[model samples]
Target: MSDTLLTDLHVKYIQNLGKNKDDLTYHMTAHLRMNAVYWGLTALCVMKHKDALDAEETIEYVMSCWDDEAGGFGAHPGHDAHILSTLSAVQVLAIHEALARIDVTRVVNFILGLQHPSGVFAGDQFGETDTRFLYCAVSALSLLGAIDRLDRERTVTYLASCRNFDGGFGRVAGAESHAAQVWVCTAALAILDRLDVIDVPTLGWWLAERQLPNGGLNGRPEKLEDVCYSYWVLSSMAILNKLTWIDSAALTRFILSAQDSEDGGISDRPGDMVDVFHTLFGVAGLSLLGYPGLDDLDPVYCMPASLIERMGLKKGWKALPRRL
Candidate 1:
């Protein structure tokens, strides 16, 4: 009930999230099924409880979401292929070392085909463009070892355009800066090995300012703090090597306090209804803060540190010293 992490209860909560297919919420969240699976799986990895979710069943579920016609994965079976869900699918498969089971070439083609002449990427064939989709393309390709197929110069140019005067990146060029956009832009550049395009000091300062007196982070100025930004903001700063700018101890306490101690998950803030997205970010934020007995999270890839290291994708980002 205190600030201590309730790892076991959280694990149970994640494990049960996909069990009730007949539940109304499950069907309602079908659009986010792929992302929700990644969130749950990565949270388990960070908690060192990856076994809580059956690997074979999980892999089968991911495969089921595959869009055969488009050669990309969808949020759920029968859904149209999207860059967002495709990235989540790749992340899930990569974590389990099941990438070999997928047709990487076709998936890579599907991702690349979404790119626009302007260098930004659309979420799907319907053409909703965002810096978020661009990041997804970059990250997914990198995980599949197909980043070499992307036009690196063109991709970095688009991201550079998204940079704002406040040293934060936005959802699109000239848009207002938001923490979530900053994370994707920053992390994408990190994977692309183009951090030189980032104004590190300025963006670091802007990201640090996301922390408020309550020790939680908000997506943008004048917004209320949300637990999910704990990952968005902290991971960006971690990628920029400026994690020390914020008070980790205070933020750690804030995240812990937001956990649903009895029901087992976390919410946007303390006392809110718990869900899988916030739960993953809450735990990941703690890991980046160097919380004791937690696994390291690769801020750039948002996967397990050990896996990123094994893949030789570790960048300059540093997590706080694990207290063991």
Candidate 2:
């Protein structure tokens, strides 16, 4: 296992992802093409290599995903508009400083229209409500400078309902606690400036327990440790100002061990096939862990810290100091 980040290899891997349109995996992931782009781009940004991808072409591809009929973005050209992809579109545009390419008023309305009276948000017209969707809405709106349109009270109440007694959150109200859900709820509250909704001490304790003896994190109890949870878990701790709770050194080593030293991507665990989703989250986790030569990541937005700060969207989270 490599003890250091293979930054150059990972950059090349991301650049090659959208190539070879005939590849089965490429076709299979069409439903998430927009999100895949955001994941790859954000990973590059965290690695201090945003220019690795062509800016104008990438922005144009992001714009092409727009679902004009719905005033939102789809996962790909022909896919229906969904809140998840819409948020990905917004984030990628924000990272590129290209938000002006989108119609803010219509996109804001499309997102607000997804919110039910219950304050929970659906992914798209199909109506599957999740706390994750709620975060996507809040975040997208904030990036567009339209957060004022959100019903703060209702949104916070809905998030409160999703909080488990264990102090972690679930996909929906009354569901079991999972680290991913905890991140959505916590980060949403952080962005909404309503983090008082969380029971900090209890949540901190629960988050700390996610770390296993192997030094990786699992999403929930009894699950195997995975690379994605490194972000889901660490970002939660960072937002809560509790970075000291995790064994950062051990977890960092675990993340580096999962890297594809030969082909350049991160997998769910060691010896698995690497992909963009895990790669972004792994690099993100490393950034929060103060890995050397990496740029700071805004845990709340999962974008570059400098970009988030410049946009006036920085939240109250703190990551470990960048190591030399």
Candidate 3:
């Protein structure tokens, strides 16, 4: 029932994440440990609390997840390398400006090796090819300043294939157009400098249709509205410079209502348990919405705009002006 973001409590909530090893959920989500760190870190940064987590320790944890054998990072220590975790690792380090700690050359090769001839990428040595993994590879490479080494035409060809008649993208060619997949695909296309491949006007209308009567957005048709789409859907619209297409005030209230006012973190919807994933997206979405007191988020990178701009990787996306 809250209309305002509980920023201070959310900060404390993020600060306390992974502190309770006795919790079963900690062990259950080991595969997402690296990404959780990235999520938590990026959330902190957008809230203008980048130093809320100890920098040395944060960067150290990122390094510990590095898989020496694969030259890329893993979800947790001793896990195998994967494109998703690799991108999270790159993002974490790049945000902290500590990319020099890892061997970029090998990491680049590890990522490059995962791409199939068809331009889609596999998640890891195992096989799960999707546009999600494709975006991960492109994003990780762009952050490393090695995207030029990627086969652009071949890569964008796969992206073009993922486009559906509705002007939205899917996890794979012919798959249903999902909001999450749309962000990854749209952001990846922006990183590749390939907006021309997208049918923006049609996609914009389709994305606008995601907003429900309650002001929250759902992934696709008939799905329940969730807080995470605050980032997924809003970010995709922001990248297309269509932020004005959605009702920001109502959507912002929807995001704030999903927050755990007393406990800090946000959930998929109000009355649900909050987690770092939704917490990050909720905060990121607010930033994009120009909520007063929040720092700007670069919708494409999902990081602080300053950090992205400093790396010379800023794109031409637009966010709403901050409230007075």
Model 1 lDDT per residue over 40-135, tens place = 999999999999999999999999999999999999999989999999999999999999999999999999999998899999999999999999
Q: If candidate 3 were superposed on the true structure by all CA atoms, what would the RMSD be?
A: 0.8
- Over 4 Å off, model 1: none
Candidate 3 lowest-lDDT run of ten = 1-10
Q: What's model 1's TM-score?
A: 0.99
Give candidate 2 misplaced runs (Cα > 4 Å). none
The model with the greatest lDDT is 2
User: Could you give candidate 2's per-residue lDDT for residues 33-105 as a string of tens digits?
Assistant: 9999999999999999999999999999988888999999999997889999999999999999999998999
User: lDDT score, residue 253, model 3?
Assistant: 89
Tell me how many clashing residue pairs each candidate has: 0, 0, 0
Error of 2 at 253 (Å): 0.7
**Against the hidden reference, what TM-scores do the models get?**
0.99, 0.99, 0.99
lDDT of 1: 0.94
- Models, CA RMSD each: 0.8, 0.6, 0.8
Which pairs clash in model 3? Answer: none
Clashing pairs in 2: none
In order, candidate lDDTs are 0.94, 0.95, 0.92
